[model samples]
Target: MLRIILLAVALCLGPIAGAAQQTVDQPSSTIAVEDSAERDAAIAVRIRNILAELEGYEDVTVAVTSGIVTLRGTTVDQALAERLTGLVARVENVVAIENEVRQTTDVVEQLDPAVERFLDRFRQFVTYLPLALVALTAFVLVVSLGFVIARMKRPWDRLAPNPFIADLYRQVVRLAFVIAGLVVALDILNASALLSTILGAAGIVGLAIGFAVRDTVENFIASIMLSIRQPFRPNDTVEIEGDIGKVIRLTSRATILLSFDGNHIRIPNATVFKSRIVNYSRNDERRFVVDLGVAYDTDLVEAQALALETVRNLPFVLKAPAPSVWIEALGDSAVTLRVAAWIAQRETSHPAARGEAYRLCLAAMNAAGIEMPGPTYTIIGAPASAPQQAASPAPAPRQPAKAPQNQDLEAQDVGVQAEDELDEMISQERQEQADHDLLSSAAPEE
Candidate 1:
């Protein structure tokens, strides 16, 4: 009976030992599987987090099974789908990627967010309607006050001598008031922050515009200064920066000149304002110069007296200023004398007076037996007969003395005609300007 018990105990212990071994092996396999599954799960979570961080992958989904990742979701486009696959493949535990992401082509889905945003804005606007209305009313009232002030011409009557400058001042005042009103309205709406943004944007835009229209601004400023100074008036004979002409009109952009040939010339106001201006018509009395060449043998004092007498007797010459002649230079052929006389430009045409002076002086010189010398050339080698001929004297030409006619009456007629024409042009321009002003006043404000 002891032997039977020992065998039975051995069989029971063998079965127990085998069962323990099997249990140990099963646990080892199970642990490995669990570790692999956990690793895969961690990798999938990491991939999802990475994709979430990236843009245009909001609808993407990541799944992992046995270390292989599968991306399945609707992407915005094929490019994003490819990008998602590439991102997943870079994960540490990921063996491969099954990219099943599709690009959605539904128009309604694309427009849904935009429509919702617009609705939200509309709701906000409706909620602020009362405040908006009050701000608008305040803006309108302030602008109306600016308009009323601009229209009151009596306040700027002192500036009437320069209408252009006056108009500019009025515009500046109106703009200042309007901007002040705008600031007040914005403050009332609790949008003072917006004012800073608006002002910054306006400054940037204004800088750009200033660069683009720099020349125009300069011309306009010069025009205002010229108007206030009144350097020259209409129909004045002027020489500006080498351009000689009669002033026709002075517009905001340019100074209009009627050239001696009757062509219209437009010089920019900035250039005109910066140049040296010579106004021939500013004074009624103007001096004219004539250079006369007489024979070297003639009496210099007697020739001067004769020229002075002739100029004084002319109708156009001014007696108070007087006519004078002086010996100017001694040349190889003759003696040069300068004859100067002052005349009333208003009563005489300068060109006509100058021409008459030349003719009468030549006649007087001839009648007085004064000779004008011809050019004498010396020969290095010449015949004896040639030298004798050069030295021989010739008879002086005689001219009849005739009384000089008064030409001032003709010049006065021409001046009166020019004045009439200028007045008509000015009147027509004024009428057109008035019509434009009326039309502008009648138009409704924007």
Candidate 2:
């Protein structure tokens, strides 16, 4: 057991000794090591002085070797270390900077292209900032004077009372001033050539993209046209492409409609602009024609008068248009008449008003002793009582011709069968004469 323990001890020590030897003999790959020592010392001293210059502040430390500077310390914020690194790098001989500094408190670092671009733009503004600022202020003052001049050019009576239009005009003037200020600032920065080059490149790229998305471009243009032309404004009820709804909003590519059932429908602006649109609320006057049928036996004069009265009494119906009634046609069972009335505003439910008018007219007719014809069946035929029979006295019974077996010398011995035969022959002759008379009556009048 002792030998076994000794062997185990030897095994562990052997690997440790070999590893230590290998580590001791490892060669360094750095060049100029001996020559760099003095330079490194100088760099360290310089970094120490620079750090000493900032030491009064809390939670920060700095380290340096050769031309490489390393920040090592706990800071209340990591951004302080980053900002210090940037300031030190601008010094005479900062070959490299490594931020080993850690924040004592939690801090969020956000790196975004838009943010970086904004910072770069801010730096540019700082370099030529004061000139740009002064130019912008002057431009605003000049644009305000331009608005004053524009207002003066127009008559006071012609000036719009709309606040929105006034605000829009102000915004336009401000935007123009800003654009001019930007051009002037670019000139001050000696960046006019760069700006032009970027603009030209952007125009070419934009043209290519526009061709690639021509349909989309067309829709965008159509949206612009719709906005400018004001074909339909928000909340206007319109029928486009057979779909009826109120305009909710107009987007770059489509128009949104709020359907009566409260659905949001998006239709392409191109389709809306190209299709026929019937704006129901555009006109203040709308006409409604009510058609009704009365029994032919009814008094037409009374019905016409009652219909006109029904329309005249409705408050929504316009009087100047003058409600008119026309007997349209004589139908199979009734006389059809149309009553037309114009209302001032079409936005009102005209169909409902028309229905109410019909009900009122029906009631008025009933009160005026005029009857609406219900479905009726009329049968024309002979009277229910006994039909008129031909006026003729009964024919006398003829003497019978005897059967051969019953033959007798006297003819008064005739039985019933002989009388029946004679009667049938007379009936057949009467039927033939009746048929001939009927055909003669049916012939042409000439």
Candidate 3:
């Protein structure tokens, strides 16, 4: 009876155990499916949030299933659609993407935001109109005041002797006032932020312009320096960089020269400032040098004495500095002598004095029987012959020319007149209307 009861109980317990196992396994599988669904929903929400944050993706929609993401809706273009897909692909737990986004070319939709922005700006400008007008009025008044102050001449006159520099000073003062006025106007209008931006841009542009026009700026600066230093005056004969001429005018850009050949030369002021200048008119007296070659057999001492005597007798030559002659070099066939004499450049013509001295010296030497020799040459392959010796020539008769009693230097009137004409021209150019106005105004009635 006990065995029979045990068999029946075992059958009932076995079925109950199997049913419990099936129930546990079913719950475990359902929990996993629910967890995966939650994870996919979370990923889809994150993708939507990310796409919304990006520009031009406001209308984009995102969906996710089991680790796969889907991007759908309209964007501006295909590029934006691809960009959305790319962004979604980077999210965690996303394995792939299905992009169904399309581009819409609706003109009204595109232009609506732009029109709204412009209208908003227009409204703001309308609100600020009165303030802008006031600022403009202040600027004009301040600029006018600057102009009036610049027209005053006394300060610039005291700054420099050159009229050009005085004008520059006036302009500088005016520009300073104008800048200050602009700053004040900008401050009044509460436009300091705009001013700062404009000034920054202007600074960059100014740097570029400065690099492009560096040479022009240098020349202009050199002109200012030359004007202040007064290196050469009008009608002064100057040789600058081997260009010999008389200075006709000193303009802002270049130094105008009237060449001896009647040609006009315009040298950049920068070049003139840096070059070596030989001014012939600075000193009243100038020395002239003559190179004389005498035969090797001639007496150098007697030849020098004769040359000195001839130069000294000339009326145009200066007696105080006197004349000098020296043996310069001894060549194969002749001896070279340097004869130098000082002449009053303002009182005598330079070329005329030199020519007269040369003529007199040659005549005196010829009459004195001094032989001026030429270069002697011999052939290399010539028949060898006995050298013939000639008889020594007798000394020529000493017939000295009578010297003038008056030793006073005579003035050359033509040079003085030419210099005066140049002075008059420069004076005319320098006569400023500002100076005239200052002088002509009848004391302003006190």
How well is each residue in 337-400 modelled by candidate 1, as lDDT tens digits? 8899998887677776777787778777877878866566654757767644455565465443
lDDT sort, best first = 1, 3, 2
How would the candidate models be sorted by TM-score, starting from the highest?
A: 3, 1, 2
Error in Å for residue 274 of model 3: 0.7
Sum up the clashes in candidate 2.
0
* Per-model CA lDDT versus the true structure: 0.74, 0.62, 0.74
TM-scores, one per candidate: 0.63, 0.39, 0.66
Q: Give, for candidate 2, the lowest lDDT window spanning 10 residues.
A: 437-446
Model 3 RMSD in Å is 12.9
Q: Which residue pairs show backbone clashes in model 3?
A: none
Per-residue CA lDDT of model 3 for 111-171, tens digit only, reads 7668888999999999999998888898888888988988888877766566677778889
* Model 2 Cα lDDT, one tens digit per residue, 1-446: 99999999999999999867643413222334343656766766666676676732244555556666676776554566666666666555555667677756433223343466799898987877787677667656666665664455244313432222333455566666555655665676566777677668879999999999999989866765665566765555678888877665555567767666656677898998899988866676777888777878877887888888777877667788788998998876678889998875433455566666666666666556564554445557567697887778855654322223322222121123432443344345446544211112122221
